[model samples]
Target: MPNKLEQLKKMTVVVADTGDIEAIKKYQPQDCTTNPSLILKAAGLPGYQNLLGEAKGWIKSGESADDVIDKLTVSIGTELTKIVPGYVSTEVDARLSFDKDAALARARHLIKLYEANGVGRERILIKLASTWEGIQAAEELKKDDIRSNMTLIFGLEQAIACAQAGAYLISPFVGRITDWYKKSTGTKDYPVDEDPGIQSVREIYRHFKAHGYETIIMGASFRSAAQVEALAGCDRLTVSPQLLGELEADEGNLKRQLTPTMGSDKEDKVSEAEYRWSLAEDAMAGEKLNEGIRSFHQDTQKLKDLLTGDQAQEKRAVAQTGA
Candidate 1:
């Protein structure tokens, strides 16, 4: 019998949710994804020292720390493109989540940087938070053939809005949703089939397939291998290295849990007003979305600080040598 990871690949596209090149080589997932947090973690890895040095070199060339961060992001993404056969998701600045124009401009710049590095736009998915402004930015980018992966999705309304905006892909956070529910209900464990996270993805999957929306649904932010196993037949799943290793070791019989089903209701395009109202009503969605953005933004700032510290050290070394 094949391992659970191999079995999962038969029904869904497995995506590595880390920035570790060594892990990507070992698992050989179909795609790879990175956000500010993942990139920050990857920056400290021994293998990425050259990329970090190059980014610092950009600072010596008069690029600001922010610009160097962007360059480093694309540099890391360029390396991932060589390993993954499918798309690599590079995120926009999380602080720009609510600013449509700035987010759009940043996404375009990231794509341009990737192209400059010889990785075409086709191999990249510009990741954005699932804010209203972010959705609008994605809508306009799609007009120019730039695909986007809408991340931090917590509610079905967000998924519907992204689908209506013609987003190339949407990543519904499974573990985060479960985390919210578990805290609220004071429950420690949930049966695999009854897991709130798994149920959330199943709802989104059914809605998309039933309504004939072309946008792909990719489940992200898993907590356990059981959560991953529950959504085995999803369109795609972006999993962390720890969970991937667990799945690789388990030789359990994985069954197809989610499949397309026809629905009697007609599809409705979500308006901005409706989208905002839906999120406002759903406390979990609103809070989680805000929290996710803040967390990513914090990591972005931390990355900048790490680079700035390096820059300062280099300057002191030069001054001491001259003296």
Candidate 2:
């Protein structure tokens, strides 16, 4: 019998949710996604030392710190593309999450960098936070043929907004939602049927399918293979190598739980005010969404520290150049 992983591949597109190129090669996922957290983790490994050295070399030249970081992002993404056979989602700076114009400008800039590296927009997904502004930015980028993956999404509001704005894809985080519920309810376990994370993705998947939206539903941030199995028929699932391995090792039956037929229940489109109010009312989504943003923001700053080391030395060098 084929492993559950193989069964899953028959139902949905499996994506590697990490920055580690070796992991992508090992799993051979159709696509891969990365964030500041994953990139920072990858930068620390000996395998990525050369990449870090390359990024640091930009500093000795005339590149500004932000430019160097952007270059490094493209460099890393370029390497990932060599491994993964499909799209690679590289994020804009999380700090620009709430600024529509800034997010749009940076996303366009990221696409240009990818194109300059000989990877066309077809293979690149410019990831933005799923704030209202981020969704708006995605709407504009769509007009230019640059696709987007809205990340850090937590509620129906965020999901609806992304779909309404014509985002290319939206990553509705699953593990983080389950984690929030477990902590809030003081429960250590949930049947896959009752898991909040799984249910959240299922609801979003149902809604999107019901409405015939073009935006793809990619369930992300899984804590277990069970959650992955639960959303077996989602458009795509970006999972860590750890869970991918677990699925590979288990030759268990995996059923398709979110097919188009299951999503046939219809509803009206939500207004902007109602969207915000619905999201605010969902306490779990609100807390986790905020936490995800802060966490990503912190990881991005850490990546900045990694890319441009020795802040005092940098300051001294800048003062000495005095040009």
Candidate 3:
């Protein structure tokens, strides 16, 4: 009999969702993903200092900060692409989510930047937040032959919209939703499979698969080994290093529960009107979606500050020398 790992290997693609090069190289995930948060974490790590230094050199060359940000982001993405045999998802700035035209423009620019660095569009997935506007931007980019990963997804409405908009993939955040439930309930104990967050992704996965929607569902932001184990047969699950290590270490029973061929029967599907009403009722999703974008936008501003601060420091040093 094949081990549990073997069954999992056959069922779904495993992806490492971190910016840690060492973790990625150690596990050998089929694909990798990085967001501003992960990149910021990586930038602060000693092991990844060389990467930041390289970006700094580019900055010193008088490259515009925006160009440097693109170069730095693509550099990390290129490394991940080389390590993983499949695509690496790199995100556009969240600040652009509401501006469809600017978002589309930025997506094209990022693709061209990747191409210039010898990374083809086929090996890259441009990640966009799953806002209606973001979906519209992705639709336009898809027409231009650029693929996208719709991320920060929380609701079925967002999932359906992404599929209808022709997204190549959707990253539903499983762990964050679980965190929300835990905080609200003030409980530490919950069955892994029955977790609200895990269930959310499973529902999205089943909906996409059963409806013959071509958009691939990738469960992201897992918090525990149980969350990863529960979604064993998902199309793909972008797991963090801590959870991945736990899965690799445990020799316990791991079952394949979320198979496409054997789905749990769901209630009547949401009508368009129901979905809109549900969105209005679910205050958490509405608040979180906006909060997530605001948080990402803030991180982007921090990154810009880092780049601009370095330049200003250098200018001051030169002025002092001349004086």
Candidate 4:
């Protein structure tokens, strides 16, 4: 019998969800996804110095902060694209979530940056937070030939909206949902199969398959090995390095639970309004989605600060050179 990882791989695409280039090179995931938080973490790491230095050098060239940041993001994305045979996800500014027009504009810019850097649009999925406004933006972007990844999706309403918007993909945040339940219950003891996050993704998988929605669902933000294991049959799962290592090292049995045929067989009838109301009732999901966007927006600001600081220093250096 093959190993559990092998069995899981047979069922779904395993993606490395990190900005850590070393981890991506080690795991050799089929694809990778990075957000502002992950990219900020990577920027602070000693190992990623070269990537940051490259970005700073561009800043010294009188490029605007936004241009420099996009270059930095695309540099990381291009590196990941080269390593992974599949597409890489690069996010748009989270601060632009409520602005449909701005979100689409930013997305097109990101895709253009990627293409200019030698990465085709086909290999890049612009990640946007799945707010109502964000979904609206995606709907228009799809018409313009720009594919998207709707992130921070917790409740089924977000999923259904993404499907209706004709998004290319949606990343349901499994671990964050699990975190909410664990904190609310004040207990760490949770069953893998019965986990709320796991169940959420399962319902979504079934719904999408049953409705014949072409939008792909990828489980994101896993907290543990069990969470990843429980979601074996998902279309894709973006995992952290620590969790991926745990899965790769474990000798225990792993089961593949989700499948397209199984999903097609498991159907549920829930209207969009009902789904939205139910999602609104879930206080945790509502709060978390907002918090996630705020966090990303904060990071984007921090990145902007870094680029601005670099530019100021470069200007001082140029003055000294002329003086």
Task: For each candidate in the order shown, give its overall lDDT on alpha carbons.
Answer: 0.90, 0.84, 0.79, 0.83
Q: Over 4 Å off in model 4, which ranges?
A: 60-62, 263-279, 308-323
Best of the candidates, TM-score: 1
lDDT value, candidate 1, whole model = 0.90
- Which residue pairs in model 2 clash with each other? none
By lDDT, who's the top model here? 1
Error of 2 at 44 (Å): 2.1
The full ranking of all candidates by TM-score, starting with the best, is 1, 2, 4, 3
Residue lDDT tens for model 2, 1-323: 88998988888999998887778888899999988778777776667789889888887776776787788888889989899888999998888888999988888888899889999999999999887788889889999998899998887778988899989999999999989889999999999999998888888887887788889999998988888999998999999989999999998788889888665454547677876777689898777777878887776666666557787754543333211
Instruction: State the displacement of the C-alpha of residue 286, model 4, in Å, after optimal TM-score superposition.
Output: 1.1
What does candidate 4's lDDT look like per residue over 211-292, in tens digits?
Answer: 8899999999887888899888899999888988887777677777887775445434445565567568989778889989
TM-score of 2: 0.93
Q: Please give the range of 10 consecutive residues that has the lowest summed lDDT in model 2.
A: 314-323
lDDT score for candidate 4 against the true structure: 0.83
lDDT of 3: 0.79
| Residue ranges of candidate 3 with Cα displaced over 4 Å | 1-7, 60-62, 262-278, 309-323
How good is model 4 by TM-score?
0.88
lDDT of 4 at 126: 87
The per-residue C-alpha lDDT of model 2 at residue 197 equals 87
Residue-level lDDT of model 3, residues 253-272, one tens digit each, is 66787877544454435445
Q: Clashes in each model (backbone N, CA, C under 3 Å)?
A: 0, 0, 0, 0
